[model samples]
Structures are given as C-alpha cells and as structure tokens.
Target chain A: MVKVENLTVRAGNFEISDVNFEIPDGKYGVLMGKTGCGKTTILEAICGLKNVVGGKIFVSEINVTALPAGARGIGFVPQDGSLFTTKTVRKHLAFGPRVHGWKREKVAGRVKDLAEDLGIAHLLDRKPHGLSGGERQRVSLGRALAVKPGVLCLDEPLSALDEDTHAEMVDLLKRLTAENDITVLHITHSRREAEQVADLQFRIEDGKVVQM
Target chain B: MIGARSDKPFLAAIGALAAMYLLLIVMMLVADAIYGFGVVPFRSDNPDQVSLVSIFSQKEVINSIKLTLYSCTISALLSIFVAVPTGYLLSRYNFPGKLLVDAILDIPIVLPPLVVGLSLLLLFNHLPTKDANFEDMLNDFKVPFLFPKGIEVTHNVLGVILAQFSVACAFSVRTMRNTFDQISPRTEQVAQTLGCSRARAFFSVVVPESWRGISTAGTLAWTRSMGEFGPILVFAGTIPNKTEVLSSTVYLEITTGSLETAVIVSLMMVTIAIVVLVAVRMWDRRNEGGLYHG
Candidate 1:
C-alpha cells in the first residue's frame, strides 16, 4: 500500500501542491495526466526520490515521509528504462537483491525467476544497449522486482513501446502484479493505458491529483 | 561538369593546407630532435660536446627522470582523489555559494604557474614557528600534532607534489564535472530506490559510468604534472637528485649551456607524452565501439 496525504513538492519552477492519494494493498493504481502535469513528480515523491515540502507519505502503513529512498522499500522504474549501460541484464536484475543484502545464491535464484517471468532469460547476457525497447523495459522491470518491494512505481514504462508491445507489457504487468501481490502506482499520459490496467484511476490537472 | 571542375581547386587547396599544417608540426619536432642539439651525423669532430649516450648515463639526469615520474604519478593520483568528490558535488548539488566555489576551483588553472608556485612558497613561509604562540598553545593542549613545527614545504618533495597537485587538480575537476553532467541523475535515483545508500549508489553506479572521464582526467593531470616547471621551480627549488624533475632538469641543463642534454630530456618527455596520448586515443575508440555494439 502507498498513501500520500497533503503532499506538496516543488521541482525546479513547477510545483505540485496539496496532493493526496492512495493505492490500496495489491491493487493497480494509475495516475493519468497530460505532459508535465506532475504525474512523475508524485511517483518520485512517494518513492522518496523527490523531496516533499509538506505532508506525509505512508508505505504499507508505515509513515515513510522522512525516510530515504533506499529505506522506503519502493521499487522505481523511471522512464527510458534507465538501465545501467555498463552492466549486463543479469547484473541489472541481480543488483537490487545484492544491494539489499540477500545471499548470492538467493540473488541468483531470484534473478533466474524474474528473468523467466519477464521472458528475458535469453537476453540476460546482453547489456542495455543491446536490448530492443521492449527488451530493455523487461530488464528494467526485472531489476525493480528483484528486491521484492511492497510497492512498484513506474513512470511511463510503455510510452516508448509499439502498440503490440505496449499491450503485451500491460498484460504482463497486470499478471505479475497480481501474482506477486505488489501494489503498483503507474503513471501515464494515455487514458487508454490507464483504463487498460488501473483498478483505481487518478488524474492530475494543474499539479493536483483528483480521483476518477 | 562546370560545378565539378570548380570544386576541384577549392577541395585541393583546403586539403593541401591541412596536410601542410600537420607536416610542418612533424617536421619541426623531427628537426629539433635531430639537429637542435648541434649533433652531427656520423661525425665525432666535437668530442668535448655532451653525447646523448653520456647524458642518458648521467646520474643527475637519470635521477631527475625518476623523480619526475614518481612525483607526477603521486600528484596525479592525489588530484583524482580530490577531484572525484569535488566534481560530484559541483555537478549534482546547488549549495550556498556554489557558483563562487566553482569559480574558485578554476583559479589554479587560469592563474600563472609562476604565481601558483610563488603563492605556495609564501604560504609555507608562514608555517607556525617552533616557539610561536599557536604552536605553544597546541602543545599546551596536548595537540601539538595538529600544528607541528619545523615542517618545511619549500624546496622539498612535498612542495613539488603540492605545486603539481594545485594545477593538476583543477584540470581533473573540470573533466570530471563534465563527465558527471552527462550522466542522468535518474540512474542513481533508481539505484537508491533499489535499496542502495547514497554513497553506495555513487560508488557502484556513478563511478563506474564515469570511468572514461576519470581515465581522461588522470591522463591529463599526469601529462600536465610531467610538463609542470614554473611552479615547481619557485616552490620546490631544483635541488640536484632531490627536487629536480625532468622539466627542471631541462632548464638546469640549458642554464649551464648543456643544450644537448636539454634536448635529450625534451625528446624523452615528448616520446612518453606521445605514447600516453596514443594509448588514450585507442582506449576512447574501444569504448566508443563498445557503446555502438552493446
């Protein structure tokens, strides 16, 4: 579960004021907005990647407002996949588990499972630069899920995908979220994408989040 | 047919100009290497003149070469150590007086090398004397190590290292800053969200990504330190076999009218610099190729 209460954030000259929302446990919540409507900002704030000027954030009933991003137990997949270019897909998948102090064997096992689930087992030896757009997105998703966080925040994960690839990814995301029991807060500008995947929907207008 | 005919002379002229510029530089270096020292080919008429073999075997010259190599290596490492954190800070954060700090960091680069050396010499001259009140106070508080006495930076190895570091670090910082600027902060943010601490994220992600920049900075600093003369001359006096680096040795040889020895040392410096530059180019090409394929 992820909850934001009266959260205010300022990024450069843009501001998101008095935002409030929640994704119930194990549900897919989509935040839809036009370009630069602060959807990504809210996701960043919830994951502790952005500083909150005011108000609280709760993750799994724990008030994580003051916590660092690392301690918040939120997996974030930024737009563009942002995979470490120097690392192989295997290393990318294993990075989170390794950082979280999992045993090497456990990390390896988790990486294998995630790779299989994401249908990226064949691309594990490849680097991000070698992967196609969809392949890169799968590697990124695998990396985020490696730590087994309670919440996954994705920022326009399918924006760069073709129509066919986007639909496939949406289905994969829905299935994976349900199977893993992970609450998701996915941001997108496309209303169709939101309707396709969201259990609950929120729209951002003028830096404010309103339930739809 | 008319347009093609007209373009021929223009292209040929520009090509000729480019080739001539490159050839002129190469010819100058070759001419200096072969003739600047007044050495005649296949002739031993001037037996009194210092031979290249004799200069290479000279204890002072050999020692200066070693000192230059050692000091440059140490100073380059030190510059990188200081540059990494400084570069990251300058790139990532906007703190109070950030612009001022950035400007100040560029001071040593723009300041005359002689001025840097002179400033260091002056600074060392103000080191606390053994009987000074500050030293006495530290001794009284059982913290004498905090401000030790009798430490001399001028005319010492420490002085050479300091002088080189002062200028080398500025170049390194600029290189690394450009490096960090090109990398996306989101990569690090994603690392943090994956449970890595800020320091861990920096070490594991940012540092790895900037390896090319670090290498470029290190090479630039090392080469700059190797060529440094004015500051080292002022702050660290060219004491034979002690503070004498390759550049200083060249100056000393020239001052003593041993032009042959000076030219030999200059050739050695040029040779080493060329090798390093070629290696750096190869590394860059390999990295670029990796990016293209990966």
Candidate 2:
C-alpha cells in the first residue's frame, strides 16, 4: 500500500498543495487529470524523486518521506520508456536486480522469467534502438518489475501506443498487477485508460487530488 | 524571378570562396612537406645544419620527440580524468556561483597561451623558500618517482605537462559538458528508482551512453597538447633531452639558423596529427556501426 498525507510540493512557479490519497494493498489506483495538472508531480513526490514541502509518504506502512529515491523500493516507469540505448534488453532487465545485490546466476534467472512473462524473450539480445514502441514499453515494464517493489508507479505508460497496442498493454498491466499482488499508482490523461484499468480513481483538479 | 537569379550568383561566390580557403591550407602544408624533402641532401655541407635525414639522426631532436610524446600523453590522460566529474557537475546541477565557476573554467581557453605560461611561472616563483630551520624538514620530504628532484616545476618535465594540461583540460571540459547536456535525465532517474544510487547510475547509465563524447574530448585534448608551444616555451625553457618537445625543437632549430630542421620537425608534427585524427574518426565509425547492428 502507498499513502500520501497532506502532501505539498513546489516546483518553480507551480505548486501542488495539501494532496491526500492512498492506494490500498493490491489495488490499481489511477490518478487522472488534464495535461500539466500536477499528476506526474504527485507521482514523483510519492516515489521520492521530488521533494515534499510538507507531509509524509508511506509505503507498506513505512514512512519513506525522508528516504532517498533509491531506498524507497518504489518501481517507477517514466512517460517515455527511457531504456539505456547502449544496453541490450537482457541487461536492462538485470540492472535493477544487480543494483539490489543479487548474484549473477539469480539475476539471469529473474531476467529469463521476466522476459518470458512479458513475451519479450525473443527480443532479449536487441538494443532499445532496434525495438518497436510496444516492445520498448514491455522492456521498461520488465525493468521496473525486476526489483520486486511493493508499489509500482507508471507515468502514462500507454500514451505512446496505438489503439490495439494500448488495449493489449492495459490487459497485460492488469494481469501483472493481479498475479504479482502489486499496488499501482498509474497517472493518465485519458478517461478510457482509467476505466479500463483502475480499481479506484482519483482526479487532480486545481493542484488537489480528489477521490472520485 | 530576378531575386532568384541574383541569389544564385551570390551563393556560388560564397561557395567558391570557402573552397579556395580550404585548398589554400592544404596547398601550404603540402608545399612545406615537399620543401623539407629537398633539404635532405644539404646535411653533409655543414655539421650544424639540419636536413630531413639529419634531423632524425640528431640525438637532441630525437629526444625532444620522445619527450613531447610522453608529456602530451600524460597531460591528455590527466585532463580527461579531471574533465569527467567537472563536466558532469556543471551539466547536472544548479548551485550558487555556478556561472562564476563556469567562467573560471573557460579562463585557460580564452586567455593567450603565453599568459597561461606566465601565470604558471609566477605561481611557482612564489613556492616556499628553504630556510635553515625548513632545511631539516625538507631533508625528510620524499619526492615521488615522477618528480626526481622534489617537486620542481619550472624548466622541468613537470612544467611541460602542467603547461599542456592547463589548456587541454579546458577544451575537454567543454566537450564533455555539451555531451552530458544532450542526454536525457529521465534515464538516470529511472536508474535511481531501480535501487541504483546516484553514483552507480552515473557509471552504469550516463558513462556508457557518453563513450563517444569521452573519445572526442580525449582526442581534442591530446591534439591540443601536441600543438602547445607558447606556454611550454615560456615556462619550461628549451632544455635539450629534458624540457624540449617537438615544438621546442622547431623553435630551437630556428634560433640556431637551421631552418631546414625546423621545417622537418613541423612536417613530422603535421603527419602525426593527421594519423591521430584519422584513427579517432575510424574508431567512432566502428562504434556507430556496432550501435546500429548490435
């Protein structure tokens, strides 16, 4: 479970004020808003990527507000896939596991399992430049899941895909969340995406998160 | 129709001027190299006179070449070591006095090389003097293997390396800063979320992505060090078999009225510069091909 209480963040001239929300354990929560409505800022703040001016962020009942982003154990997939162009898909999947001190053999085993589950096993040897948009997103998802975080944060993971790929991704995300029992805080601008995936929905209006 | 017709002649004139400028430089270099070849037979007329063959036969000239290679290589590598972190800091962070720090970094590049040499010389001149009491402390001070005589800078190999590095490092820092600026920060943030600390993320993600920029910066630093002259001349002095580099060799030859030897050294420098440039380009192309195919 992930919770933000009275969260206030200031970035440049913009401010997100007094936001309160929670994603209950093993549920898909979608934060929907118009563009530039501070949705991504909220996500970043929860993941410790952005500094919170006032309030606390709790992950699995632990107050991670003062923790560094790397210590938060929150998986984040940014808007773009942002895969390391120099590394192959296999290496990308193994990066997080290696960072968490997993041995080489364990990392290889985890990478194989993720690749098979994501249906990207065939593309393991390919670089990001060679992968299509859908394939890159899948690799990114695998990279995020490689660390086995309690809560996964996705910033518009399907915004770059076509309609067919979009539906396929939504289904895949739902299945993954169910199978892994992972809580999710997904941000999107599309009502259709929220309806298709969210178990609980929240909207950002005038820099506030309002549960709907 | 009239404007289009008028633009054609103007564009053609600009293109012709650029072509002429490029051809002029190539012609001058080729002419100088060929002229050096003609002086190969004149060495037997005077023992002090220099010819293409005699320049290589002279121990002083050969030693100068070796010294130039050693100092340039060391200075270039040192510049790269300093440039990587400095570039990353300047590229990624915003803090108080950032603009001031940036301006100071560029001072070496913008100032004349003679000024750089003069500044270094003045700084060394202010080194602590050994008094009777200090002599006891100095007796126990051990110098490293690279500095045999206890950290002497002026008129020494250390001075040569320092002078070259002062200018070379500035160019390297600029190149690496531009390289880091072009990379997206999202990749680093993602790495952090994946349990990698900031330093680990930089090494695993940022460094590997920037290999081309690192190569380009190193090449520029090496080439700049090879061509450095004014600073070394002013600071290091033209000490034969010690402080003398290829550039100093040319200057010394000219001072001794051996214009042929100066031309020979210049020709050798030009050849080495061309070979280094071509090799760097080929390596970049190979990496680019690997990125596309792999």
Candidate 3:
C-alpha cells in the first residue's frame, strides 16, 4: 500500500499543498490531470524524490517520509524512461539488485527473468540508444520491476508511445504488476489508458488528490 | 541569377576574412618551425652552431619541460578535484547566494592573468603579516602544508602550480558545470529510487556519463596551464632550472638575448599543445562513436 496524507511539496516556483491520496495493497492506481497539474510532483513525492514538508507518506504501512529515496524501497520510472545512457539493457535491469547487494548469480538470474518476462531478452545486450521508444519503455519497466518493490511510481510512461505500443504496454504493465503483487501509482493524461489499467482512479484538483 | 550574383561578394568577403585569420596563425607557426629547425648560433659562450635538438637537450630546457609537464598535470588533477563538486553544486542546487557564488567562481577566468599572478603574490606575502590571519591560524593548527614556519609559497614550485591551478580551474569548473547542466538529473533520481545512495549514484551513473566532459575539462586545464605565462611570471618568477616552465623558458631565453632558443621553445610548446589537443579530440571522438552506448 502507498499512502500520502496532507503532503505539501515545493518545486521551483510552483507548490502543491494539502495533497492526499492512497493506493490499496496490490492495486493499480492511475492519476490524471491536465498539463501543468501536480500529478508528476505527487508521484515524485511518494517515491521520495521530492521533500514532503507537511505530512506523512506510508509505503507498506511504514512511514517513509523521513527516509532518503534509496531507503524508501519504491521503484520510479520517470517520463522519458530516464535509462542510464552509459548502461545496456541488461545493466539497467541489474542495477537495482546489484546496488542492493544481491549476489551476482541472483542479479544475473533476475535480469534474465525480467528480460524474458518483458519480451526484451534479445535487446538485453543493446544500450538504450539502440532501442526504439517502446523498447526503451519496456527496458525501463523491467528495470523498475527488477527489485520487485512494493510500490511502483510511473510518470507518463506511455505518453510517447503509438496506439499499438501503448495498448501492448498497458497489458504488459497490468500482467507484470499483478504477478508481482505491486502497488502502482501511474500518472497519465489519457483517460483511455486510465480505464484500461487503473483499478483505483484519482485526480489532482486544486493541488489536492481527489479519488474518482 | 541576380540573387546568386549579388551573394558572390558577400560570400567571398566572409571566406576571405576567415581564410586570412587562419593563414596568419598557420604562417606564424610554420615560420617558427622553419626558423627553429634551421641551424642558428644559440650558444653565446661557445659559438658552435646550434640546432633545435641541441638547444632542447640543454639541462635548463629539459628541466623546464619536465616542470611544465609535472606542474600542469598536478594543476589539472587539482582542478578536477575542485571542479567536480563545485560544478555539481552549481548545476543541481538552489542555495542562497548562488548567483554571487557563480560570479565569484568566474573571477579567475575574467581577471587579467597578470593581475591574478600579482594578486596571488600579494596574498601570499601579505597574509602572514596580519595578526591572527588565516594563514597564521592554519600554522597555529599545525596544518600539514603550513607547519615548519609556513613553507614559502611565493617564488616557489608550489607557487607555479598554484598559479596555474588558479586560472586553469576556472575553465575546468565552467566546462564541468556546462556538462552537468546538459545531463538530466532524472537518471540520478532514478538510480536513487533503485537503491543507490546519492554519492553512489553520482559516482556510478553521473560520473560515467560525464567522462567526455571530464576529459575535455582536464585537457583544457592542462593546456591552459601549459600556456600560462603572465601569472607564473608575476607570481612564481622565472627562477631558471627551478620554478621555470616552458612559457617562462621562452621569456628567460628572450631576456638572455637568445631569441633563437626562445622561438624554438615556443615551437616546442606549440607542438606539445597540438599533439595533446589532437589526442584528446581523438579520444572524445572514439568514445562518442563507441562507448557512448545508448
């Protein structure tokens, strides 16, 4: 479960105040908002990328507000896929587990499994620049799910994909998250994407998250 | 046809101006090489005809070359040390007085090299005079470099390195800041979410990505240090065979009326600089072609 209560975040000149939302355990949640709304900001805050000045954030009922981003145990996929430019697909998938001190064999096994599951086994040796937009997103998704975090936060993961790729990714995300029993908070502008993947839908209205 | 005819003079004028500037630089260098390689009488004491090889084989010239290489290497490494953090801070943070700090960082770059040298000379000479000054305080605290009655800095080898660092690091810091600015923070942020600490993420992700920038900055600093003359002349002094570098070797030879030797040393400096620059460019191109993997 991922929960935010009265969270206030300040980013540059803009501010989001009194924001509150929750995604129940193992449910897929989608956040919708118009351009310039605080959807991405809220996702960043939950993932510990932004400082929450005014409230508590809970992941798996643990108060993670005071923790550094690394300690929060949340997987984040930024809008542009934000894959490490220096790393290949295999390295990207293995980064989380390797950093967390998993054994080499375990990391390799996890990487191989994630690659097969995400249909990116063939592209594992190739770096992100070699991959197409959809392939990049799949690699990014595999990277996020590499460590199997309890909560996953995605910022406009499908915003750059074509219709066919988008639908395929939506199915892939749904199946993957369900199999892992991960709670997801995805930010998107498309209502169709939300309807397709979201079990709990929320919207950021007037700097507050309102359940729909 | 009319438009094309009208554009001829403008295009010719533009090409002429660029070609003229390039020609001047190439002619100057080519003339230096031709004259330097020519057998010119350099030894005033013994009038045995001297060539570039004989002049460069002199102990003083060899010492200057070694000092220049060693001091510039140290200065470039030191610049990297100071620049990486300073660049990251300037790139990523919004701290108080950020603008002021940024302006202050550019001081060495904008300040005249002569002024930088003079200022450093004065700073070192004047600091110990004041009661309870920073230098004295460091002395009191038994700092490693300051112990034993505060080791002499002005007119010393250390002064040469410091002088070179003061100017070269400014360019290094600027390059690094631009590099960090170009790279998105999103990758580091994602790395953090993947369980790497900020420092770990910086070293593992950001630093690896910044290889090209770091190389460019190091090369810029090193070459800048190599060519640094005014500051070293003012601060370190032309202590031949001791504090002398390649730049000061040119000055020393000129002062001693060995214009031929000075020109030869200048040619040597130019050759060294070109070789280093070409090597760095080749490395950057190779990395861009291959190691820039996605």
Candidate 4:
C-alpha cells in the first residue's frame, strides 16, 4: 500500500496543502491534472525527492516520512525516464540490486529476467543514448523494478511516445505491474491513459485531490 | 542582393578582428620555431652554446625538468580532488551566502599572482599569536621518519607544489562547477530512489558522466601549474637543484645571461601545452557521440 496523509509540500512559490490519498496493495493508481497544476511536485514529495512541510507518507504500511529517498523503498521513474547515461541497459537493470548487495549471480539473473520481460534483452549491451524513447522508458521501468520496491511512482511514463508506441507501453506497464503485484502511483495528463490502466483514479480539482 | 551584400561587410569585420588575434598567436609560435632552429651557435661570443643535448645534460636543468613534471602533475591531481566536491556542492544546493562563497573561491583566480604568493607566504609565516608559524609548529612535533629536522614548506620544494596548487585549483573548481551545472540532477535523484545513498548516487551517476569535464579541468590545472612563476618565486624561492621548476629555470637562465637557453625552455613549454590541449580535444571528439544529453 502507498498512502499520503495530510501531506503539505511547498516548493518555491508553488504549494500543495493537506492532501490525502491512498492506493491499495497490488493496485494501479493514476493521478491526473493539467500542466503546472502541481502533479510532478506531488509525485516528488511521495518519492522523498521533495521535502514535506507537514504530513506522513507510508509505503507498504511503514511510516517513511522521515526517511531519505533511498530508505523510502519507493521506485521513481521521472518524465524523461532518467537512466544513468554511462550505464548500459543491463547495468541499469542491475544497479539497484548491486547497491542492495545482492549476490553476483542473483544480480545477473534478475537483470536477464527483467530484460526479457521488458523485451529489451537484445539491447542490453547498449547505453541509453542508443535507445529509442519507448526502449528508454522500458529500461527505466526495469531499473525501477530491479530492487522490487514496495511502491513505484511514475511521472508521465508514456507522455513522450507516439500513439502506437504509447498503446504498446500502456499494455506493457499494466501487465508488468500486475505480474509483479506492485502498487503504483502514476501521473498523467491523458484521460485515455487513466481509463486504460488506473484501478483507482484521482484528480486535482480546485487545490484538492478528489477520487473519481 | 543589397541586404546580403551589407551583411557580408559586418561578417568580414568580425572575422577580421578574430583573425588578428589568431595571426598574432601564430606569428609568435612561428617566430619561436624559427629562432629555436635557425641559429647555428645560439650566442656569438660563446663558441660552445647550449644545444638541446647540452641543455638535458646539465644536472640542474634535468632536476628542474623532473621537478616541474612531477610537481605540476601532483598539483593538478590535488586540484581535482578538492574541486569535485566543492564544485558539486556549489552546483547542487542553494545555501545562504552562496554568492559570497563563490566570490571568495574566485579570489585566487582574480587576485594578482604576486598577491596570491604573498598571501600564502603570510599564511604559513604569520599567525596572530606569533609564538611560531604553522611550519615551525609542525617542525616542533616532527616525526623521525617524516620531518627529521623540521617540516619546511616556505623556501622548500613542497612550497613549490603548494604555490602551484593554490592557483591551479581555482581554475579546476570553476571548470567543474560549470560541468556539473550543464548536467541535469534528474539521474541522480532517480539513483537515490533506487536505494543508493546520496554519496553512492554521486559516485555512480554524476562522476561517470563527468569524465570529459574532469579531464579538461585536470589538464587546465596542470597547464596552469606549469606556467605558475610569481608564487614559486615569492614563496618557494628558486634553489638551483632543489626548488627550480621549468618556469623558474627559464628565469634563472635569463638572469645568468643565457638568453638562448631561456628561449629554448619557453619553446619547450609552448610545445608541451599545445600537445596536451590537442590530445584532449581529439579524445573529446572521438568520444563525442557516446555522451547522453543528461
């Protein structure tokens, strides 16, 4: 489960106050709002990238409000699918596992499995610059899932893709998240994207998060 | 046709201005090359003039070369070590008095080289209490293996390295700060979210992506150290076989009326700088397409 309780985050001149929301375990949640409506800021706050002014964030029923981003056990995929530029796709997949001190064999096995599942096994040796937009997003997804975090926070994961690639990625995301039994909080501006994948839908309406 | 022709004159004016500087620099290099090779015997009075072979044969010149190479390399390395963290901090955070701190960091770069040398001299020699300066204090607690008599930096070889490092590191810090500024913080944030600590993320993500910048910074520092003279002259004091670097060697040669040898050494410094700059530029070009936008 991923939950935000009375979360108040202030970033420069923009601020969100007393926001509350939750996604049940193994379910997909999508948050929709217009541009500059504080969607990415909320996602950042949840992932521990932004400091909370006042409130609690719980991931898998554990209070992670005071924890650093690394200790929050939350996976985050930014808008650009921000993969480490120097690392190959395989290394990207293995990064979290290596950091967590998983055995060499386990890391290799997990990387291979993730690559196959993401259909990026062939591009494993290539660095991020060589990958297409869809490929990059898939690699980003694999990297996020490498450590098997309790909750994944994705900010407009398919916003950069073409129509055909977007539909394919949406299907891939839905299947993969369900298969892994991971909770998700995805941000998107597209209503069609919400209808396609969201188990629970929330929108920012007049400075408040309202469930749809 | 009229608009296009009018723009041509404006373009040519700027181009001519740019070419004037380039021509001046090229003319100097050409003059050095011609002078370096043209004269049969460098001095007319002295039949046995200093040739390239004779220059290297001298123990003092050889020692100066070794000192210059080793000390400058070490100074460049030390500069990079200090620059990386300092640059990263300046780039990533918004702290109180950030502008003040930034200006303070640029003091070594903007201050007259003589002032920098004098300040270092005073820092080591002048303590407020005045019981003993930092050097003497360290010398008092001298370890048998390390500082048998006393740790000597002022008027010592170590002072040569310090003087070079003090100025060179400022350039390195500036380069690294700009490098980090060009890179996005997005990848690092993502790394942190992947269970790597902030330090780990920096090492894994930011450092790897910063290779070209790091190399450029190190090279700039190294070249700066090579040309550093005023600080070494003021603080280290050129001792023929002890503290004499290539720059100091050139000065020594000129003072002793060995004009040819001084010009030859100047030519050598120019050649070394050109080689290093060219090598780095080529390496950058070779690895160009491999870099990511982030």
C-alpha TM-scores of all predictions: 0.91, 0.92, 0.92, 0.91
Clashing pairs in 1: A129-B294, A130-B294
- lDDT, candidate 2, B1-294, per-residue tens: 655556778899999999999999899898887788776564466776555567688899889989988998999899989999999999999999999999999999999999999988887744444432455446545322233334578999999999999999999999999999999989999999888789999999999999999998998999899999999989998899989999999888889987878887898999898998899999999887666334
| B59-154: candidate 3 lDDT, tens digit per residue | 999999999999999999999999999999899988899999999999999999999999888767643432456657667443333423456788
Per-candidate TM-score, first chain only? 0.98, 0.99, 0.98, 0.98
Candidate 1 off by > 4 Å: B1-24, B36-47, B129-147, B284-294
Lowest summed lDDT window (length 10), candidate 4 chain A: A82-91
Looking at model 3, the pairs that clash are: A129-B294
Q: Calculate model 4's interface RMSD in Å.
A: 3.5
Top DockQ: which candidate number? Answer: 2
Model 1 TM-score is 0.91
The C-alpha RMSD in Å for every predicted model, in order, reads 3.6, 3.6, 3.6, 3.9
Q: In candidate 2, which residue ranges exceed 4 Å CA deviation?
A: B1-17, B41-50, B129-149, B292-294
Report DockQ per prediction, comma-separated: 0.60, 0.66, 0.61, 0.54
Per-residue CA lDDT of model 4 for B130-232, tens digit only, reads: 3455666556443223332345778888899999999999999999999999889999999988887889989999999888899999999999999999999
Q: Ranking under DockQ, best-scoring first?
A: 2, 3, 1, 4
What docking tier does model 4 reach?
A: medium
Which CAPRI category fits model 2? medium
Q: How much native contact recovery, as a fraction, does model 3 achieve?
A: 0.76
